[model samples]
Target: MCNSNSLSPVWRELKRLQSTDELFEILSPQSFKWNIGKGTQILFWYDIWVGVSKLRDQFPALFRLSGKKNEHIADMVIFSENGLMWWDIGILFPLNEYEDLQYQMLMSLLRNFKVDLYKEDEVQWTHSLEKVSSVAEGVRVMVKSHIDFEFDRVKVVWNKLVPSKISTFHWLAIQGGIPVKEVLSYRNCLNNSSDDKCAWCLDHIESIDHILLHYSWSHKVWTGLFKWWNIFWVVPSNVLEFSVDWSNGMGIKAEKVWKLIGSATFWAIWLARNEVIFNGSYTCWAVIVSRIKLKVFQWLVNAKVCESFQLYVWSDHPWLLLQSPSFDMF
Candidate 1:
């Protein structure tokens, strides 16, 4: 059983040292209705203990009006000498700007769900039949319910076979989360030096699509990859389209290989870009193509996609493995 005074140790351990704002993220998805045994455990402002939503969410104007955003249920509720319950808004607390209807709604909700300080507050999970769930389970449920932008390319970016950092970088690039010059300009991080040009080509702005696809060096890298695979497909205009449409006209096994190799292609280009940006190294298209080949081979072999592929065969005829009769054996 979880401790009645606090959230479960497992959940708390996951967010033990986090700020109150961060704690709201963990608590928001946890369908925990408070059975207030002692009112100390219930957050008066932020908790969704009474209604279908948190009080802060239900009455944002009223919540902002109150000075005690973090006050507990016990702090707000008090008993008279005659044993009647009433709210105590605290000494000199600002309570001046909420609509009358909002206050009436709040009082009405509180009246229906009065807390008992004598009993130890209990937390119940509404998400589970057992009224208990782990932090990881809660997080999974929250993500599944709330996140709306999942895509196949994004899913490929989180492949366990790929390095997490590399996958995360790929995900960010796809989402345009990288701090490119345009982004820096938007955030007012750049001086007026006009240094936002693609390091390889001084013609256009250094957007993610330009850096990964349209720039002269990046184009060469993609063309080189296509030639290596014995495919003459035209490159798509964007990364997502490139990822999804790159494997067209290939067998299922070939498509898997193509997707993994596609990830390697993006990763290699980013590495080359970083090399140029950070180390002031030159962007050699041939060298980048070579690196992409090597990276794809390494990831394939290590991830057990092509465990038996010799380095020499992988170097010369990588696509042959994908088309081989025993390709599934890999």
Candidate 2:
């Protein structure tokens, strides 16, 4: 076991891998580098200390002739009596013309490089602003590299106005992974076809679209929101289409509030559905509309969108509240 007490924060994190029973896999080397300090802990040839690549890869022929192949960076430096630093890379054999040229190029590259003898070597994650290695940063780097397409729908799904749970629900809903009755039936969780009826209406199959959008109960919820915004909108076939169309129709001034309201509307309807199914609560669209308004008003106040926002004004005439001078900053 490595002594964690002696290691830097980054190395200490890396050391935890040794305790795992599974075969250790190396992460992408290009995403990491050593921030050379004293350089005592970093391998001169093998580690990415000097540049974007390791010295061994950059000068393979010179590395083959090096006597101290496994030497640390500290071992390659020689200090004169006056404290001038000089590189004394131990070359095992005489250099040909091409090898001598490589040697001169290597020396030139190291001429301006300075190492602090007092400071300890540190590992840096190239992708993060802090240059510190972390699981989250590593995952982000890896995911970003692999993703080739533009995922603009994620911007619509993950709204900063709502909690992560709400955003997560939206994400799942977009992917058709939400446990609506139809999905449950498909997964063999619901044995009876009768159990797949819409929880709100019980007239149509409880699909993601029906329960959340097209059904009379949920449709009224959307209609109430549109009436509040005073905009004519044709509800799309599905959640993703609805989000795209709604977003496209928003004006610059009302865009932020509109997005927040849209997210709140979906969440409110879902909550109402759960309550009706699980708690045997009342299935009134009017009550759910009131809840959506209250939810959005509270979110605006909590987010400090406007200090003087009145709920009564928002409930009666949300358009006027949005048009108020207080919201001009938005």
In model 1, the worst 10-residue window by lDDT is 15-24
Q: Which stretches of candidate 1 lie over 4 Å from their true place?
A: 1-153, 247-253, 307-309, 323-326
Instruction: Write down the lDDT that model 2 would get.
Output: 0.72
By summed lDDT, the worst window of 10 consecutive residues in model 2 runs over 17-26
What is the per-residue lDDT of model 2 for residues 149-245, given as tens digits with 9 covering 90 to 100?
Answer: 2437767766677888887888788767899986775455875534777877776668898988988878888888778777777888878777766
Estimate, for each residue in 158-253, the C-alpha lDDT of model 1 and write its tens digit: 665667777777777766678777556434476642455677676666788899888878889888877886777666777755655654434334
| Pairs with backbone N, CA or C atoms under 3 Å apart (clashes), candidate 2 | none
Alpha-carbon lDDT of model 1? 0.67
The TM-scores of all predictions, comma-separated, are: 0.51, 0.53
Give the runs in model 2 whose Cα sits over 4 Å from its true position: 1-148, 249-253
TM-score of 1: 0.51
